[model samples]
Target: MKKKIIVAPLNWGLGHASRCVPIINALIKDNFTPIIASDGSSLEFLKQEFPYLETLHLPSYNIKYGKNLKKNLFLQLPTILRAIKEERKIIELFITKNSTVSGIISDNRFGVRSSIIPSIYITHQINILSGLTTFFTSRIHQNIIKKFDECWIPDNSNSEFSGKLSTSSRKLNQKFIGALSRFKREELEQSIAVLIILSGPEPNRTFLEEKLISAFKNDKRNVVFVLGKIEAVQKSWVINNCTFYNFLLSEELEHKINSSKVILCRSGYSSILDLAVLGKKVFFIPTKNQPEQEYLANYLEDTKLAPFSEVANFTSEKLKEVKFYKGLQVAKVEFDVALFSLFHSKRKL
Candidate 1:
């Protein structure tokens, strides 16, 4: 019988879920039965990608970020804690019912681990940068991660891509698995001058959408906007030489990205990896008051990887300043090798 592995990702945005694609594929290729568990659009996305695999609808945190994100986060702390407690119960019940489950891989879902099984926690944010709570949250985050058998970071081990985000203080059990992007590099003729990808939790996603639309309304450059709404039916329309897509499949998204001259998107790490893989120039607009996004945008700019501007100050001049980003230089290896190494090492014990 094949070993069963439960794969869960946080539903804050599609970033966590999107990054898991490479991991899931690796698990399946190794003849492990990978079961996916997530909430909302993340679950829907995984289901659409792997219809052959079993999936469960885990409870959502149902958390929302307001215009003032720091205040919103502070207000929602109690609710978030309650959801985490509920998630622990759900994990307990699922594991008890599913006797075949051998291990767990949680992508930033804190309560999905079990003491009885080998559990791995995956996250790129080792040093969380939330205002005021930065130090406190980092301690708490590391404590929770310690409960897992191993912590897997998705950036280069050399700390070239993530900088302090993934490389601050290395814990003994943490492993850097290098950047994991579902899309591979492909050479294609450029058709769109700019490709805008909108993602993240509610209000912010909508806010960015409106901002980008208004900014590009009068521009003559050929633009393609991907709304990143997976729950809605796929739709498209063209106006003023700009094309808009409700969502696209992985293949379509990869193709469109390759065919674009530049990308405009949030500074989410997953999106950054995808752009890096394609070697595309990017102009990032960090989501308002989300310190992680703000930190990443600034890090990229400081590292000379990409140029970024705040949503309020985004303009054509700023877009023109985006230069080609030379991606991380890491030794390439098979995607499955990193995942398999963990399981193989454990089996030898």
Candidate 2:
């Protein structure tokens, strides 16, 4: 019988879950039964992607963000810690009931691992980039990561796309898995003049959507806007000069991306990798006051790979600037050999 593997990703935004698509697909091709575990939108997303696979909820972090960073973390930090504990319990219970499950792969979900089985933590941010708390936060994350048997970085060894974020100051069992993206470059016609993909947590998600829609609603150019909302069923509607989707699965999204002349979205790491893999030029507008997103946005621009703006300051005219930036950089799927080796190897812990 094939070994069963638990594939869990954090439900922060679609980034974690979306990147896991390639890994999950790899698991299937390697003859492992991948049981998708996540909560909220991430779960719904994977379910849509692999309806044939079994899925379970791992408890929602239900993380929300406001314009203020200090207040947001102070209030949500406790809740996040509690949720991590809760998810650990869920993972343990699930593994207990399914002894056949041989491994767990968690993408930015700290507590989704088991002591007995081979557990791997997937993240690009080994050094958290919050301005003042960068050290504290990075250390805290490293501790959580150390609990896992190995760390899988979704970047190349040079860390071109991820940069220092993917680099660890101190080494743990680590592998540079190259870029994990569920997309590839294609020569499709540009049916979408602009693709506005809005994601990240809570009111900010809605805020960006509203802001972009308000900006483009009266424009002559028709744009495709994808709102990464967590819902059981996918929905679509046309408003003004834009077509809006509640969410889109890989196949549909891939087409939309390939067909777009210009793309705009949160500078979320996963989206960055996705664009990088497709070699698509894009404009980034970080979610308000999210330091990580802001940092990533600036990092890409500083690297001359991409341009970003504050959502409040972004306008229709700004899309033109994307033509000047270099877009994202990518490496081949460098982790596949390493991933397959570990998947079949004896337990790391």
What lDDT does candidate 2 reach at residue 176? 80
For candidate 1, which ten residues in a row score worst on lDDT? 340-349
| Whole-model alpha-carbon lDDT for candidate 2 | 0.85
Best by TM-score: 2
Please identify model 2 stretches exceeding 4 Å from their true place: 334-337, 345-349
Q: Compose the digit string of candidate 2's lDDT tens values, residues 1-349.
A: 8888999999988899999999898888888899999988888889989999999887787787786875777788888889889999988888888767889999988889888888999998898767788899899889888998899998778888777887775877888877788987788989789998888887788888889888897888879889988687789999888898998889999989989888899999899889988888899998877877888898899988888889889899988888888887564453374565655655435
* Candidate that would win on lDDT: 2
lDDT of 1: 0.83
Clashes of 1: 0
Candidate 1 structure quality by residue, lDDT tens digits, 166-246? 765646388888778888777899989999999988888998899889889999989999998995468899999789998
